[model samples]
Target chain A: MEMEKLYRMHSDRVYSYIYLLVRHRECAEDLTQETFYKAYKGLEAFNKQASTATWLLKIARNVTYDYFRRKRVIKFFSFDKGHDLETNALSPESRYEQKEQLARMFATLSKLKKDYQEVLLLRKIQECSIQETAFILGWTEAKVKMKMTRALEALKKEFHKEGGHPNGTIKRI
Target chain B: MEPSKEFDELFEEMKEVERSEEAKRNTWLALKGRIATKRKRNIFPAFISLAIVAIATFLIITYSIPSETEQSAESLSNEEIIRAVLEREYNGPDKEHLRLMNDWMKFQSERNAKNQEEYDELLESKEYKDFMNYYQTTFGEYFTENMLTKAISTVMVFKYHYYLEDTDIEMHLENVEIKQEKDHPNIYRPIIEVSLTNSQGQKIFHTLREEFIFSKSEPGKIGSYNVAKGGGSIEFREKIENFNSYVGGNEDVRTPSFRKTISFDTLCFNGKIFENENTQKNIHGCTSDRKKINSILKIFDHLPIKEATEQESRKRAEALPQMDNYQIYLTNEVDKGTTFYTITLYEDGVLMFAPGLDLGILGDITTAPHAVIYEKVKLMLDEFSDN
Candidate 1:
């Protein structure tokens, strides 16, 4: 019940973060299960300085990378280079169906340096605080802020480059 | 031209990207199996604790503390059933935490000279650190220090209590409406209404309908699993609506292409239309202001993006009935004199309704918080006011 209670409190956010990283539903769920199992095994190490959400996310991040390591898709330079990074089915344009501009923004986003995408997802999409984002990325807050500015600038340029038009929609057959 | 404003709206809109219930349930069901083994291993410690309690009770008391499972769960009455459900959520370990939080909240919120002095002394006392340690594990979600000091209005307090105890400042369950689906005989539907008086002396209400499926053989149980759905339901249903689909071989898939534009000549916003003075365009407006019309139409270009299902649309309408409706009409071909697209804006929240790419898309609507589209239209109108 204790571990189950913890899962009920924080699994969705953890799963969401992992899904975006892994790009496969089943893979993400497996990673989420692994992260919780790790947390259960490593409960003594939790020093109470961080929120349970924060601690769980740190574990989830590690579990996802460990999975990538096992798969031998070791992407060092482009941290955003996860499975399906280039897939048309999972493009930002298709992911955001409500707003074409948002779809455009994400499309532009995917084109930037992959590190930029990594920072932006944490800062922008996840809505993590700078301190939390820094902790998860194992970078300083100053670096996170600096990277965010550069990423937004690059995104603006990429967005305007395409005239932000020709919005891609998947017509099924 | 305001990229900043555009980005702000898009970022805010990003929050509306929904997660489906299927995902949440599937992940939990799959993970529970692995956890069950760990739970079984934990029983040994409890066995040892029970032995220790037996030895201590002979020295300390005349009788042993009674076993908890004195009665079977099978024969629980309706009152007992509801109690079982609530008891599951507000477990024994959390009751003291809940009570202490409420007391701390009262001290923080309704603080007078007398109460403040007592609390300040308590803060100085050694128990404060022990108290903080006690609550750290219980309130893993909220910032305890922040709750006690800053953040006016006790919103976090209210939210914390609401999630844990089905309570706000003071929550009262008004009623429960029970019904059985005629088509699905074994399924039970309970519509529960709860009202709470917030710290601001205002009433806030929440009503949730949770389905409990009963197997005929099991008289007391409601399905294999149940979760009271009050705390964690997302606004955007993550179920992607079918816009375009066909078949390939024996398998099924879709090739999605993003569309940037849709066509309409006549724009009717909130029952006001401007007629194109030339009349050749067959467009009508409030004052024939094409600039305002263009700006207004620009916002809806790719809009009504995600389609809401009939069930989800109906659920939202019932849940948020306070929203005022404002409908807009767009004519595809004025010569045909038919309304091709329709947008009905609910004032509290924005729900854009439109014709589905000239397809048979009935519920072509997507919701955004705070009537963003309505505000955008108003802003465009103000920009072109002189014209």
Candidate 2:
């Protein structure tokens, strides 16, 4: 595909994946650019084996992981206070309840193992098909299915621990 | 088994997370520019490598052949053959010269290989990767990729002053907020809070929120949007305090205390302007233009004076090249209590105003205003030459 068309088709999914991984707007934006730049440079290496979106997301995932490795020391000491502040959607008073519930769920998700978080985000949140998730993650379709099952169970346990019912409603303890 | 409703709701919220339209546009522009530059740069290296190979081939051909005199005289050593050839071609050929040439070539080849390895490693380095990522995110469509890289040796903090139709504005990274849209799950908005200080010293602040929608699927592409301005306020002092506290405990933070203020009655411009210094010209006495002092003073007055963080001061000290014998002197009456301040002008046209007594304060006059001052000074000097 032409670079422009490729960018138009997949940039958002790529960017959102990076954002979910890094949880920083500036960092996510940077990683997204890096992913595309890498895609552009490595375009010759890209075979038609997987869809373009999966390839882009794979690059995005690697870029974000590279960032995490670089920032591991800083991350250990500092809680990312800026992550929750990134979303401007809940500024309205009416959406406060929903926003709080989402925040709680996100908090639970964030505490999960990195791989679990990745599996759930790709399978459930991004709503990627098992094959696409496998392609992007460089995993087998069977592994993605197994991981998704385990991730969903882990998320449910964490949510319940956080006073959330299995139905997804939050109960303030 | 079906995914629970709670998981679905959470996933639904995650689906709403996306790149703003403005961000998408900016990233596309940045990516396009980067790709173009990469193409151009790639071409140049190919040409360079080709030229290098051709030159190496020519050198090998020319240097490998033994001369008739050497062949007739005796079977000479490689060093002796080189010496004889040098002596015949030029005047002097010492044993040391052949050794030096061999050593230099060996050094050059080794250095070249080392440098190539380092460059390759740097391409894969985390710092370089982060730099590429940050460059696109921080500047976006506002700055070209090459502009950020022109001076790789120097640490430059770019402050963009955007001129709207009626209002002039400046935004720091601290004031920007990015969030998902509540009503539309697939959209994200980046709202920048702008604090405008009017002539009366009263501050009027407003939020410039993005109006365009962005889809979660293609978060990098920003759609068209008008800025919705809303009422807000900026607490400048509080922000400064917070910044100071953040960097306070670190020894690298050079928190210079305020020293006594100095007043100057006269200014002098000296050193090489075009080629060499014509003469030491006094701005107060040389120029017949009555507004000369005020014009110069206007530039000084508008300098962005602020307490320099330790990181900024250190970066400035390291990055700035050694200045030539350039000096701008300010003097006042002895009884009137005069102060002399030193201003460092960078090759890139950034001026750092460092007051006397080693005041921890550093004033930065960005390139635009610094250019204005430089032009004004040159014009004043040209007037002197005309006479």
Candidate 3:
């Protein structure tokens, strides 16, 4: 059945998607359980309008966002620091060549706010198409393009500040 | 300008990621439980046909029974046969049968109220508490997770106790219960209860009677408990055999709700579970949100004073926000389904036990109904302690 195929194809990807947002292995596991429950319960609502992957992606994204909004708002409302960035381990000496550039880049990206982060992550990391990104984000394709461009431009300016080249120093930050 | 391929890879590398095979398996199992429940609910349509059959049978029996003497035979011919067949049909060595048996027992419980009362009296006797405590300490580790959630419109606290014989093996708690209630149709009020118990029987002390309304995750609400009457003092003491018998059919009940319980040999602290490192890791790992983590730390800030351990201090360090400098440590152990959370908070090198804010959020999410009722009793106890 198509249902079984959808499960085989998307289960891992959906698991990966949720694993990033929750950060805890156990919670991501629980949420993944919940996401699949929603998918199976609403299978009748599939409509075939979107691919099963996209449909499941929407459900997983919604679950992650719900958790983020509920759990993140109460504790980190006043937080300016991105919890994700702290988890990144980069030594200063190794990346001295591009330290300022990367710092500027992150600083700029962080400053632009949460919406920009979503669009950038969707387009660049997830490699979602402009339309797919928009659909996932409930934005128009034009909006996705505009946001992606802005995020990229912001990153470029940071690179330019550090000498306009990556230089392959391979520093950990 | 777009990020170059190299930068993209770098960004990907920065994405902190770790996957656990155990966690994946847990997820799949939970999904399986949900799917099974859904399938069970699919019998709703069939219930209508059953209703019709029952009605027709009742009519025939009523007309055929000319005297009260004929009632027993008709009942035997009808109800007894159905009950017998059903009991036989569902008599497999499966969990579902156990669950049905549990349900049947519950349905049969009204007539057994006297027995429950006698048991309650026996337990309430001072002799019983002493005997239970003695047995718990002398025999082996005893952990109990009684009342998944209690406190409908009042403060709810769940309790777990861990006992050790040789090794200080104890209960660990992992899941928190969150409850949301509606007075009218639209208004939603949230309550919470903490659920922690290890596979072995250790206990966690979560008192529900305290005032615990954290920030209203939703606004335009009362933002506090405003009830007229009928709430307080959720009791956690019950006969284990009876309690286990109630939920014996459900295999899910057998799984340690908490991550792991340390044995008596592993007792990091002198007498209590608050001293274990593994317990601390499990508590922090339970919730991924920094906000919730901070909220938990805030709760820890209110616990009554206790001596600290290296492992305990280390556990608190793990919970500290990377950007902030508040020392908050949480350690817990679950033995036999009872979970205990030992939280120590330090600020600027000072210790503190954050007072009650009524954490009944766990009361909502817990699937167990009796546990919810019991949390209300905990809420009352919290008030008593405050007084």
Candidate 4:
């Protein structure tokens, strides 16, 4: 596929995945660019065994991990004192509540082990198939299923601690 | 049980968080530029080969041009002949050495450029803009132009340092209210509420009530606001039960190690100097001495020490048995608030300095003004020890 076309078709998904993992918008953008750059460079070697989306995502995952490795110690915050989390205007009250809950959920998700986070993000959040997740993560189907189960359980427990009931009811404190 | 339907809804909401059109265009442009650069780099080997051929041709031409003087020059000593040849062909270092130096310089330039790019990107972020907006909205009304700028800059420095080491924590501005002090009607108190949550589900609800004591002469001017006297308290809440105990008792948590320690001799604190127990002495100095001590204390106050990962703490424990020489101490009352620094310098040249245990793992003072502080302390100790 042409680089521009490939990017146009899948860049949003790829960017979103990376953004969720790194939780930094600018870094996500850079990593997305890096992912495409690598894909463009390695386009010839790409075996067509996986879909282009999967291939791009695999590259994205690797690029993000490489970034983490280079910055072995991830800095929690930059030195600029005026930093604040981005906020958008609320339309309906319910939408605002949902957004807040989602933010809380993601914050909990970040606490999970890297492997668990990767699997759940890819399979559940990004809506990648089990096979696609396994391929991206270099895990077998069985391992993906096994890890997914464990990841979900861990997430559920975290949710429960955050006032989320097992029956999917969330009580906001 | 399967994942909840609420999770599906949350995931759908997450999809909405995407790259904007401008971001997409920018990313594509950047990708294209990088690809073009990569293609250009691919031709570097060909250029190098061509250069080698050119050099060979030049050498052949030089060697072929024979003169009666050149013929006679061969009769000189081997070293003399080599010196002459080198002087004729080169003004300084050989081509190979120059090439290596050029490569090293290029590498350094590229790394610096990458760092600058990352910093620029960070400045352009929405979160940074929001932070600036918050400050401007809250303080802009009362601040003089210069005072506002200085206040924002000071706050930015604190925010930057705080966030750099605590990226896992999310900061939310809960509220910002401007009110008058109870007795002092003219004095404005901007009560800012900020909520912070870390990855471990621990939350800190902080209420910063700043007493914006404006000058009587310039009633609402920025310079009038006294920031030095403002203070706040943090209220901790754990979303997860026993989160503190988990973080505290569990030393196996994995934390990043950014600073690396190097060798240093001598140690100094305030007026006391210690090279060895017997060599320790008290020293007095001019006004600049106090300034220097204050600077060192400021750096120590911001040392990036965090709790070691459980695995790291274990590894350290195992290694401690082998580390026979290590010195740990607290500085004498640096101020009235009982503020002191804990410094652990090992025989193997590792130094771990921090203000207190709750702040996190003791970090190496290997970077920047901190490194400068270390050197100054060392020099002070050396001077006193010599005396």
Candidate 5:
């Protein structure tokens, strides 16, 4: 496929997926840089497991997951910057309902463990197939299916406990 | 069926909201910019690495050429000569030279009681000539000038042997009369004052009138030396060309033989030189003043022609650790309180880390050490490696 045509076609979808993972515009922008950087570097690795969009989304998913994994590793070791101040989030009404939902999704998702949150986001919201999700997360297909079910159930429980904000309503769609 | 169609409408609306051209361009542009930046970043480091290689090569070439050319003319200081002599004895080809020196010291001591004829015989020995020749040739010209000077000085010493007791041994300058004693013709007595202090700053002991004996004879010109108890005896007779002039009657000189050894009971007591409150305050003040001096000197060291920027100052300040062996901690902003400076000796690596101190004086915050900031990034990398 022509690189420019592929970029034109998939860039919006890629950005949408990334926006959900990192809510802030600046962070989302940075992640998009990392995602494309990864994509360009590993362009030859794209074997036909799914569509090119799915392949790019998978790359974005893994990149985003790796970012969180790095962050968690740092936090776990007490090597991170101190959580000295509360973080700020975007307004719910500024973007469209889906984008807003994605932003809201990130705020809550940031609270969950890296593994559980990654599986849930890729399988549920991005609507990636079980095999694709498994491949992207480097998990077995069966494990992806099992974890996706468990993660959704866990998310439901968490959303209900938090009184059903965007994350709770995300499931109703 | 109609309600299902309405639900499809909601999904279409969701897709519409999710898919935006602006978001796509923003993300693509962001990625494109980063790729450009990554490429740009490599250029500077590549250029810098080449520059460093060129500079390092130049320095090594310059350092090697001069040292090899002037190997003979290189002059060693007294300290260097002492270290070389000590090292030679440590790794001597044969222990014969060592035995000869020890024998000479003993024979010269014993000759003091004998007649001139016996003393003269001792001085003209082949072993003495061999020892002198070996020291002069092995050490080259550097060692001869310094060693000869040191050997001919008058030495005054007070023996405490008592580590726990700090003694005050005073040698009155007025009482320091240099007089040739009638009994010992070659020796003259000069009184000198000495003081000793214990760890607790207590004067544990006191003394006076310690005598230092020195020979007045010209060392290189001395044809022979006579050692005798009664009426003196000539131990050796050798016509040497010239003698070292460190004996007496010349310019003011502090002979190392008039050495003072301050014995300390413990390691804590050994640092008594700096442990004094006055000394502590003096060092603290001196370090701050030196920082300013270094700041001004660094401007010349780095720029040579231009003034320093904040970043330049920061880099220069960081490099100061190499100049002075002290570790500087940028405890606060450069504009704030004095940064603490300490010297740390790491035994494992045999490394010395000295960071310069910044007291925030001179109203120039630009002079703050950059090591404090640069170390943060290193600490982060170390933490990453640990995981």
Candidate 6:
């Protein structure tokens, strides 16, 4: 029961973070499960300096990074999964605009370099602190800031130069 | 710490990416099954029984006896403090009074010069009395016996104020920083960036950095709240929460480790790269060849640089590079990492692209007081440019 509760509390964030890296839902799910398995094994040594969520993210990042390091092959991660959760907007038109903007945002995000994508996702989207981001990426805090500045510039430039969305919508899993 | 305002909306949407319930359930079930197979908490039943008994005994011993002192809010973790603030159970009236006090501060400061006599006069003034009466009437239930300490119910406005009564507030806390003033061990300055919006077609902002000092004597009360710009109100620094502290939690939380200060680092431009706002960095990669670059830039060192007028400085600092200019970026690798800054050289002046800002120059002409008049900056670029 305790394990299920912990998974329920944190699985989505872990999955989403992994998904952001892999851009594949099934693969992200598998990796997330792997991350938990690893985390459970190491649970006895968990440090309390950071929050449980931050610790999980740190683990998830390593699990994902290790997967890439082992695979070394860049799969063409197209945004072909076309499903979105219902928007809470009162107006249908606003909801559609919100959905389209989100789609456009994700599409633009996909175009950046993988490191840029991770920096943007972790810092800007996930809203981690410089310290927390450093902890997750295993980079120094200054590196995180520098990467964030560069990543924001690249993302902004890409956002301005963004054209049609050839990659289909995100399924939001 | 944040992208510019335009990205805030998109980030808000992106953060709403929810794992579908189906996927979450499947992942959870799969993880649970695998974990059960791997460990199953082997030999844990007796240990679990011991832990439960110990916990129950500890709880009974801790909470059963009547204690003279209540727990201090300082003992709560940052998460608990935020959660307590969000609970709205005891904080509704407390926060509302804080708003009242903040508005009163604004009103009083606007009306009078911020001297002690003026403050005392304001306190006796009819407006002050009316404000006091309004606070008492609205929040008397929380602090009927005591009138001085405003946040008796817990929670204070801190470094910045919110016009809470003017609008309904929906808040999301992103981070917490625990700052301490030296020699005052009991004072905690917990800073947080809060995203606030109003439900009633009112003023809304994306986020705000609010820092408030929590006193051990009286938790959730205002101190050093002089947010009014240019207002040197001495009374603003007065400890407003001198009342008794009350909460129920652990007694010795020991002021959750002081926030980490970013160590001063060896940086480029004699640490000029560190001046960019919003980030405290420890970078080691100064361009080893800067002496070579600066030697080429020696002409401007002899120019009647400081004689330039404010207009000239402004124009040169902000002006676009002349058409006759040479352009090159002096890249200083940050911490030997891929992140580096580019310093631009023009025929007339030098422009260093300020990191953490959009296409603006802050430390121009090598952060010189005057703009460049000589071609030596371009010569400096020429000495190094690939072209």
Supply DockQ values for each candidate: 0.08, 0.23, 0.17, 0.23, 0.10, 0.17
Worst 10 residues of 6 chain B by lDDT: B239-248
CA RMSD (A), model 1? 28.5
Candidate 2, B1-387: lDDT as tens digits? 354454785577667665689988888878877864674334212212333334434544455454453342234432232233222212212233234334434443454422234434433433333333332333222222332232111212111111211232222221333455677744545544334343333232233344434323334322233333431112322322243332233333232222235545555444333333444332222333436655655545533344456776776666443322233445554422343665554433345566652222255323221333444445554454422
Off by over 4 Å in 3: A1-7, A72-111, A158-167, A170-173, B1-6, B11-18, B42-387
Model 4 residue B109 CA deviation in Å: 26
Candidate 3 CA-lDDT value: 0.39
Error of 1 at B235 (Å): 55
For each candidate, C-alpha RMSD in Å? 28.5, 25.3, 24.6, 27.5, 31.8, 29.8
- Tens digits of per-residue lDDT for model 5, B309-369: 4564554445433332222232333333443332221111111222334321111221112
C-alpha lDDT of candidate 6 relative to the true structure:
0.48
Q: Where is the poorest 10-residue window by lDDT in model 5 chain B?
A: B232-241
lDDT of each: 0.50, 0.50, 0.39, 0.52, 0.38, 0.48
Please list the residue runs of candidate 5 whose C-alpha ends up more than 4 Å from where it truly belongs after superposition.
A69-113, A165-173, B1-23, B30-387
Tens digit of lDDT per residue, candidate 3, span A40-96? Answer: 767755787666766777788888888878776411112123222332255765445
Q: How many residue pairs in model 5 have overlapping backbones?
A: 19
Q: Give the docking tier of candidate 4.
A: incorrect
Question: So what's the TM-score on candidate 2?
Answer: 0.38
Candidate 4 chain B, poorest ten consecutive residues by summed lDDT: B258-267
| lDDT per residue as tens, model 6, B27-95 | 877886675444222211121233333443454455455346434344665335534443332123346
Per-residue alpha-carbon lDDT of candidate 6 for residues A14-99, written as tens digits (9 for 90 to 100): 88788766777788889999988787766655867677888999999888878988999543223556445458754786677666
Tens digits of per-residue lDDT, candidate 1, B228-301, equal 46422221111111101101121211111122345556555342222343322111234235565666665555
TM values, all candidates: 0.34, 0.38, 0.34, 0.37, 0.29, 0.35
Each candidate's interface RMSD, rounded to one decimal?
A: 7.8, 5.5, 7.4, 5.8, 16.0, 9.6
Best by TM-score: 2
